[model samples]
Target: MDRMPRWADVILIPLISLILAALLSALVILFIGESPIEAIKLMISGALGSTYGWGYTLYYATNFMFTGLAVSVAFHARMFNIGGEGQALLGGLGVAVVLVYIPWPHWTIALLAATASAAAFGAAWAALPAYLQARRGSHIVITTIMFNFIAAALLNWALVGPMKAPGQEPATVSFPEATNLPTLHDIFGIIGIDWSRAAPANVSLFVAIAACVAVWALIWRTRLGYEIRAFGYSEPAARYAGISPFKIIMVAMLISGGLAGCMAINNVQGEAERLVLNAAEGAGFIGIAVALMGRSHPLGVFLAALLFGFLYQGGAELALWMNIQRELIVVIQALVILFTGALDNMIRMPLEKIFLAARRKSPPPPGPDRKSTSAEAAE
Candidate 1:
């Protein structure tokens, strides 16, 4: 039997962890001579108060959703693909290449082409590291980390040398006007709702939502997902069952990299309209925390991404209006990541014990033959 109920594992544990993180953050704010209550009010108001705030929050959530799903996929196969940063960069390059070189008649076709290009470029970048790990038995973590730097250098060279615009800027020229995506404001305006034009959230938000659904189906409703989870659970047993470890590693990493690359559609094609240096803005690394908090489930990943997005948009608000240092905001975010990810067991163990005790204390239900058993015993 399981130590705890599935619902507790999926929902209760994360909820408790988030509460603890919030309490710790409140303490930190108190120590810094700021009112935690006021700080929280500002966060809620600034990140969720108006359409503008929602726009930014959802925009950030979109990026996190893609990257979180990437980490979740690889993690199912027991592989830590930390090279999302590099993969996302390459994906941006792919987006730039597609949008800059090709002349598409419409935005929809351009969006589809850019997505494919991004996924392909991201997968290609990950292929080498996957090969090294699968064939040579090299550690995936170390290799993927190294590849991040290599990918950065390559992107830098590409931008500055070949793909650079006519000016001194180390970025490609702006994408064609026809390729520009419709913003949330535009979409909502059609439905008779006014949205903030300044907000970056766009059609990619829907794409992110679709990706979540696709991932859930892939991970829970597919044969390959079963093999990946089985391999992660026990590599030796998987091999005995005819599951190929090499295939699992390569396929998982490729999928992970492709998902990571897909983030470019949100930040690059949807928002920026041109790829720039550090375009990823550290969303790739943030994905690790998102995956950890979400428990590597697609639904969990979506919710966790939303939470992180709130923090991001709220943090910016805090800095602008509250005069709170950016570092303090980072500290708050770190504390959240710490409790939710690193100190997860601190919350989980207690919950397990509590549930177990409750289960033990509960009375057993009457059996179908209870009266007959009692009569027989009396006789």
Candidate 2:
């Protein structure tokens, strides 16, 4: 049997990354003329102030969670997908188109239609890059990055022209109230909180959690995932093993792009309550950082996304109290990615030594020693 990187060591990489990110965040606070302790305190209080704040944090985390998992899935297949931002934007556009054209459909029907449309659009948007990687040997980084720009421009053009809401100031078409996702309070029917103070804890959180489980199953159990991992190891090896790299690319990009689109339901349908041009809010890009920090593990990415989600939802309160710019959170996210990527190999040191020692103790190749030839010549 061949050796593989130990699973446990893989889990520790993100834990170290997060500790470093927190320390860097504190340094940011000190630089901005505020007590690090005070600033952190404000972040905690604001993010968890009450049931309402917690709900909002969960809502934001839902989108991030989906994006992070999408990126992680691609990473597991040894592909770097940079177009999550665009895939998500295209997904958002699909929702807008469905809402505008559909004629007063029931909420359940609308939900299904919107979800299926978003997935189809996202998969289509990603398919071209997948094709290039499969047939033309194009680098995913270049293709996906270029595609992201194209998606953004196309989305903006559509929103400002053909998809524009009639007589509206914003560059968006609002979904009909009936087609919109139900708020936590409205659908849950456990109300009586102040409207201003309380927000609808978007149902998308559950969807995000469920997506994680699905990813875990896919990565650990499915034949498609097995082939993707084979390609990840080496293309030649995968070919020798009868796995098709081209097919793997298509499957990986489809799931990755679909998840990117699915992430928007958390925002366009649940958070923003309106179809907006910038609904992605860079969550797709940040998801790369999250996936890297988590070392592409499903649970690790989940926790990492929630941690960043904490920073995001708490940024304003921290900024005011700590006299720092909100953009500091971006810096912290970068630091996490850097440290995690840098330390990945180092984190494997212990397991590497163990495997090496085990190899040394094993038997050699199935052949007799060559010393007899030299002895016979001497005789």
Candidate 3:
């Protein structure tokens, strides 16, 4: 039996952790000669206030959703795919390859081609690392970390050498106008919603939502998901049940890389219209916190992604208007990650104890058929 109710374990723990994180953040802001309440107000107004703010917020959320789902999938197989950064970079390369090389007549076709290429390139990049881990017993954490640097180097060489536009900056030329994605405004305008015309938010937001639903189904409704979860729970038992460790590891990482790679569609195809260095920013690493806080669940990941998205957008506003140091935003994010991931037990253990004590104190329900028991004893 569980020490706490399912609701408490999933909902209460994260809620309390977030509250504690917020309190600690408030204190930090207070110490730094700023009104914590005002800061929060600004954050709300800046991130959720205008259509423009919503656009940026949702854009960041879209990236986080993809990367978070990627990490969550690998996590179910007990593998930490920290190479999302590299995979996303390769995915951008894939987008670039498709957009520059293809002769698609319409945006929809271009989008489809870019998606396939992005996923394939990302999966290819991850295959070697998965092979080493599954076959040679190398640690995935170390291998994936190393791959990040290698990916950076490769991208640098490609951009500065063969792929750079003639006498232009170290980026590919802008994608063909035909390949340009429809922004949120275009989609909403169809329904008369009238979103901001200049917002970078696009159809990719819907893609992120679809990805979330797909992941939920993949992790919970399928036989492959069962095998993955069973292996994660106990590898020895999984092997005894005829599950293949090599297959599980490889399949999990490949799916993870594909999901991570899809983030490039939002940034490169939807927003940037050209692949550039550091296009990923730090979304890949932020995904670690997202997965941790969300407990590797797609629904939780969606909400957690929105929270971080708010922080990113609001932090920019705080730094711009309030003269708050930009690094303070990093500090706040670190505190959230620290509490939700590292100090999780600090909140959970106490709640478990409370629930257990309450359960023990409650009287047992009345016995069934006490008269029958007495008659039987007498007999």
Candidate 4:
């Protein structure tokens, strides 16, 4: 039996960690001669106060959801695919290629084509690293990291050369008007709800949510997921059980890369309407923290993505109105990541002890067939 209940492991530990991180963040703000309480109020109001705030927060969250799910998929197979950055970059290239080169009759068809292209490109980029790791015993982490730099260089060359718009800017031209996606504002307007037209959140948000559901079904409800988990648990045991490590590694990384690539649909095809330099905006790295804090679970990833999204939108607000430096915002984000990811045990261990003590202190339940004690009977 487990020392702590499943709910405690999933919810309570993370909650406590977040609280502790908040306390530390408050101390940091005080040291910097700012009111932490006021800062928090601004964050809450800025990130969740109005429909406009929610639009931005959800937009950022959509990106995190894809990348976080990518990390979670790879993590299930005991692999750390840090190449989400490169994968996403290539995915953007794919989106640009499909949108710029092809003529589409409608947005729906274009969206589907671009999504397929992005996933394919991302998976192709990840294939080599997966091969090296599975066959040549090369480390996945090093190869993936190196691939990020390679992908950046390749994207730079493409953008400045063949894919460049007819100007100095190293970005693709705006996608055809027919391919433009409907924003959340537009969609909501159809339902007779007022929403901010300036917000970037769009139809792609539903796609991200769908991806989460797909990943959940893939990881926990399929035979392949069983093999991946089996391989992750112990290679020797998995081998004994006739599971192929090479196949597991390749499939997991492909899915991971594909998910990472799908993020392009939101940022590139949905918001920017063109592929730009540094289009991913560091969302790939933020995914690691999300996956870690979420315990590699889809539901957890969704909530963690929202929290990080709030931080991002809220941080922008702080910089605008509070005169807080961007670096300080980064520091606050790092503290949250630190407590939730690196310092997880700091919260979990104590909780486990508390639950264990409580379990011991409680009286044992009566057996179905056993008679009650005299004191119980009298009562």
Best by lDDT: 4
Q: Score each candidate by Cα lDDT.
A: 0.86, 0.75, 0.85, 0.86
Better candidate number, 1 or 2, judged by lDDT: 1
Please estimate how well model 4 matches the true structure, expressed as its whole-model Cα lDDT: 0.86
Give lDDT tens digits, candidate 3, residues 1-379: 4576656766787788888878888898888899998999998999899888888889999999989988888888889889999999999999999998777799988988998888898888788999999999999999999998898899888888888887668898899999999998898889999787877888888888999999888877899987888888789999999999999999999999998899899999999999888888878877877777787888888998998888888988899888687667677668777887789889988898998889789954454233312111111
- Candidate 4 stretches with Cα past 4 Å from truth are 364-379
For candidate 4, the 10 contiguous residues with the lowest summed lDDT are: 370-379
Q: What 10-residue stretch in candidate 2 is worst by lDDT?
A: 370-379
Write one digit per residue (lDDT tens) for candidate 4, span 139-197.
Answer: 99999999999999999999999899998899999999999999999999999999999
Instruction: Tell how far residue 314 is off in model 4, in angstroms.
Output: 0.7
TM-score of each: 0.92, 0.86, 0.93, 0.93
RMSD of candidate 4 to true structure, Å:
6.5
**Candidate order (lDDT):** 4, 1, 3, 2
Which run of 10 residues does model 3 get worst, by summed lDDT? 370-379
| Model 1 agreement with the true structure over 158-210: per-residue lDDT tens digits | 98999999998898999999999999999999999999999999998999899
